[model samples]
Target: MLGPNGAGKSSIYHSIIGLVKPTFGKIIIDGIDVTNIPTHQRCTKFGISWVPQYGGSWSDLTVYDNLVAIAELHIKSKEERLAKVNNLIRKFELQNVVNLKSKFLSGGQVRKLTLAMSMVKNTKILILDEPFAALDPQSVRMIQQIIVSLQMFEKISVSISDHSSRDLLSCVDNAMVLSEGKIVAKGTPPRSDKKY
Candidate 1:
């Protein structure tokens, strides 16, 4: 999703993830209406995962510990969970700082850890809100590449909201522009010079 700030982009994302109840219309995921489902049930029932604009994570925990915690909450079996976490850490190149406290890592490293944590459960839909906010151009490009790689390899449905139309459209297969509380425009095969 490509939208200007305060366009209710995050509101829509919250509604889809079951964080907020929709006033009307239905939220159908994997052919099921989940608008009434609870937040915790949204993940298992709808196979969705959400990472907020801030790149959700535990600031006090080490990178590995944060992943392990989320893994435990959403996955069963210590051995299986550990293996999966380890695989993603290596896949995302997080091994070098996996043991460092999240507060100690650079902005880009923290973003990577947050993304790796989101991938722990193999979700069907991954929603990221304003992922590149405050990121340098180089950092934003790196994150975009990682997201594209994940989608290609895992075949995961991704929804991303960004202030930069160029970044979001370039990375996503589809684009939707929202203004004030509604979708203003939507298209596929994003234009290189597209602007929101």
Candidate 2:
């Protein structure tokens, strides 16, 4: 999804994830009607995971501990939790900063950690809001690469919302433009010479 501020892009994501209910329509996922389902059930049973625009993390906890905490929530076995955390650490290249508190991480590291935490439970649908916000150019490139890799290799359905559409169009197969709580356009990305 791409839209300027106040375009209700985040609301669309919130509605899809069950945080906001639709008054006039049904919310379905994987062929199931999830409109009335509780948020926790929607996440656990429907494999939906969300990463907010500001990023979600236990700021006081170490990077390693943050990953372990999320893994332990859904994974009961101690060995499994350790394995999952370790794998994410490696995949996100957090080995050197594993012991550092999450508050100390750079913008790119924080984004990586948040993404890894969201996928700890093998979520089928991942929603990220304003992922490139507040990121430096280098961090934006790094995060973009990671998102592409996850979509291709992990086969996860990823939905991303950004204020600007240019950077996101190249990576997405489909996109919708929202304005004033309505979808103004829905289609594949336009070529470089065309403007939204």
CA-lDDT, candidates in order: 0.81, 0.84
* Candidate 2 TM-score, C-alpha based: 0.86
Looking at candidate 1, the ten consecutive residues that score lowest on lDDT are 187-196
Q: What does candidate 1's lDDT look like per residue over 1-196, in tens digits? A: 8777799989999999888888899988778898888888887776788888774888889999999999998789999999989997887678899889898988778777887888888688888887777667876777787778768888888888987676777787788888998889988854564332
Q: Name the candidate that leads on TM-score.
A: 2
Q: Any residue pairs clashing in model 2, and if so which?
A: none
Model 2 lDDT per residue over 25-78, tens place: 988888999999989998889788999877599999999999988887889999
Native RMSD of candidate 1 (Å) = 3.1
Off by over 4 Å in 2: 190-196
Candidate 2 residue-wise lDDT at 53: 75
Error of 1 at 149 (Å): 3.2
